[model samples]
Target: MANKTAPLTDTEIRQAKAKEKEYNLGDGKGLLLRIKPNGSKLWLFNYQRPYTKKRAVLSVGSYPEVSLKQARQTRLKYRELLANDVDPKDYKQEQEAQAKEALTNTFEHVANLWLESKRDTITSGHFQQVKRSLEKDLFPSLGKKPISTLKATSFITLLRSIEAKGSLETVKRLSQRINNIMNYAVNYGLIEVNPAQAIGEVFKKPKKKHYPTLKPEQLPDLMKALNTASIQLQTRCLIEWQLHTITRPSEASGTKWSEIDFKQKTWTIPAERMKSRIEHIIPLSEQALALLDIMKSINGNRQHVFSSRINPKKPMNSATANVALKRMGFRGVLVSHGLRALASTTLNEQGFNSDVIEACLAHIDKNEVRKAYNRSTYLEQRIKVMTWWSEHIESTSQNHLLTTKKSRLKVVT
Candidate 1:
């Protein structure tokens, strides 16, 4: 029978001196320490490869650096792998490679990739907002972490910080953005699962707030106020242009003279400029057309219909309408956006087709079939609806003049 190899002790290793030849002293179960002629020591594990029975060796560490107890623990771990039909050397090498890969595929690196994909799909302003959110909130904390190991807990602290500021909407939006990035990773086969899907659920939700608007009865006061408000002529015309066309502030402010069609009596808003990322055509009423003619005399040579006072080459500041509205003593009572609501209420009270009015406002319908049908079939009715709305506004403005004892010619120019 073969003599059983005895386990090594610290005393024996401490007493062992470097020899003339490099040699190894074996501990039980294939762990050996080589004491080099140069007095260097190394711990190694010798094993047979699973299935093939080929011999292989794994380097654990240098002696004393890897103590006897640590060498024994490593031997037992390799033995466990062998029992499971796994080659310990191959497994260790694979784990090391994955560790290296994890370091390279960091959260910031992957997030940057996800952001680059959005550069063309979203508007420039929207893209910058998303980028700012990531940089401001997420990247500082979790940026260096391997995305393969990211968890919901990874984002909790970050979310809590923003939440403490009473920004539940910001928390909700960031959670969604994180989820989108993780999903982007999963789609590209970079990760097996997304751990961030439910992070937003733990936070409080923000209540939905609709735009503050004036009631239908208050339209005359607004019309009178607009004519006499201490705002600039360009601002008044811009307000009238938006009101007559029933457009969003940014869409109106960003309007180009090239988009106007005097012959078609249409103003075409391109898809990229629109909120829904779909092109919209507004039927110009006589009032809208006349407002444009007035603007042509002021800014016909410029790119934007409503050019900025500071920079004529650029579009009007989107907030100009709201600022002017605030200055007119209508603060908190109405906003530029509320003009659309007032029109909707007045038109609904008049018993016009709800669908045609909604179409004219470019409000997207959830039902794709209905939306497509409305897009095609509502233009004729929309023309009639727009004409009627303009007529109503004209009559109201005329009435405002009559209601006041003195005619305040509120025309800006």
Candidate 2:
């Protein structure tokens, strides 16, 4: 129960200054209004918790700044938290600790710290995936360099070296990774400008390569084999989800249970996790909805859809799906990510409008006039084209309905 006593008047407050037990004066039960012998009042809260067996003191406010009504309200909120099986003291302590940690987390320091902290947040398996690229390819070459000194030219040269190695795709993703690091550095106030900006302008993007897609005749047997593969349930779901919606394998694999909007049949990916720093809205196909329904039956409560068997909090290692393809004897015949290439190439070869294809791949077309004038990826046209492509892939893969019929692609978006 809360105290119902009247607030101490100024004369009473002055009188209390002369007594020892009543030296402190305040309206709240725990908050003490300490009166200076010369007549000044300060408010404080005294309490104890059983777990630590520690007595803690909290200062409410001083004199007129913290009125009798205001100090009482603060006490009520804290008591309510304690009554509801919560520990207000513990909550405050944790908040203080987090603030302290965040204070020390400077840009240069936390760049390394962010990578290390993710070790527990991600898996050893996924950690190895990120480590090989960050350490062997990236960090060793540029890790110690101060972020402020990293110029656009130096950043481009670093990528060009990797591009020279025949991994055009790696170059693309490396640009993304470098941008992520620079963005992290920006958050920690290490740098004002991102060296990775205008990356597309800085480096020549390789001609988009085609993925080795299964011919229309191959879909049924592949689906059947996938259905019966004991260890590949999660992988199959991830693959089907990507195919049905034309999403990147990484985006599909990292789908958080919360990001799914089942009612709207959409998956909105945040820009931070995307290759482009733009939010991507993937309009789900019916096939995608079905796959999500099946996925929910198995891993509904977990954070990630394709969580590692060892760690349920993080997504499965990127290699897991690709490696499974190898084990199933589809290594050279098929690839986990080749699906995107397959979709883009086959759709173009089939003669769909180029704008539709670009929209499907989330590619933006820019020209001096159009670039300045048109910015939206026309969802109306894109929706129709993507639906047709989904139907085409599904039809060919399942029933071997091969079509040489083609449409001229016009990149209008």
Candidate 3:
């Protein structure tokens, strides 16, 4: 038989609590109220897990805050969740824990921790580069979202936007940083999986082959135009070194005073900071060395070799070289990146061994013999090659000599 239903009232509720020892009121459907021997009233919901007879007691809020109406609402909500194949009480607890944790586990919070942890291990300039990439590329889109809610598709969109702008390599590196950041989050138990790991499936990477190289005879005109343009000195030097050293602009921009050995005429790029994650020894030509000397007067006390004109503490923006070239009326004619290809093609045409040229470029030693002996980066040959190219640049820049019309016509042909 069902218990008689009674309209809930403040007085009746109070009396019900006071007289609970004598008579317990049951809500007639697994809900019941208990008045403890100590006279405390607790609202309890009794239910069975769907398809199982295991009964469970769900603690509803205590008396006043969860008045009879609020308690009834909670009970109904839980029943609704159960009817929909969800465990309401378990989900409720899970959500509460997630909310409490989200207060402490924000994207910035995790990213800061990740950056700080890597600061000492990574070079100062590389530290700044990663920070910049995140600020420019990742943060605007996903920085505020909870790390837990970052889905693979969301990260794919971020990388795709960068690729659309013609920065495919940047997309790969950014994906790695994102993966690393999420891995850090995972280490701290903030997230279970790295959403950035799914980038291979979501994004299309252009097949890797050699980048296009510029010819030797074209170098003189290119160098002359870049130097005579009204670009800043730092931008000029960065482009010049990018050509002479055959290093990535990131590597060139991030160079430090400590890495250069003026006496030995070598620049040792450390493993942690190198894109290859292996220490790279670059042989500096007199021309590249001279450029560094000029920068010293400007950036001697600063930590970075190519300090920003506006902010000495940070390195020159990675795009400054390319941007300056574009503004100098060389749009599409050259890029900072084209310098690497320029050196490779010029050196190869000049009869230098391909392995030596590759080594000079600080490329990973994929050749078994070269990789085995670590006899890559033959400094003497590189110095000679770079010096020869440097002389060619200085002579051509000084004399404003254009390639002969015959050569230009041949190029067009």
* lDDT of model 3 at position 360: 72
Per-residue lDDT for 91-122 in model 1, tens only? 89999998998898889989989999977666
Q: Give the Å error, residue 259, model 2.
A: 2.1
lDDT of each candidate versus the true structure: 0.85, 0.67, 0.74
Q: Pick the candidate with the highest lDDT.
A: 1
- Candidate 3 local lDDT, 1-413, one digit each (tens): 95575645656667864553534456645556666766677777888877665788888866766687777887888888788877767878998999878776777668878999987676666788889888888888888887887788878877777888888778878888888888999998888778777676556675685533456787767767775788777778788777777788788888888899989988998887676667888777667788888888889899889998788887887778778877876676677877888867766766777767776776767767867554533766666666666655555565322221111110100
The TM-scores of all predictions, comma-separated, are 0.84, 0.49, 0.61
Clashing pairs in 2: 25-33, 350-406, 351-407, 354-409, 354-410
Give candidate 2's whole-model lDDT: 0.67
TM-score of 3: 0.61
Give me the displacement of residue 279 in model 3, in angstroms. Answer: 4.3
In terms of TM-score, which candidate is strongest? 1
Steric clash pairs (candidate 1): none
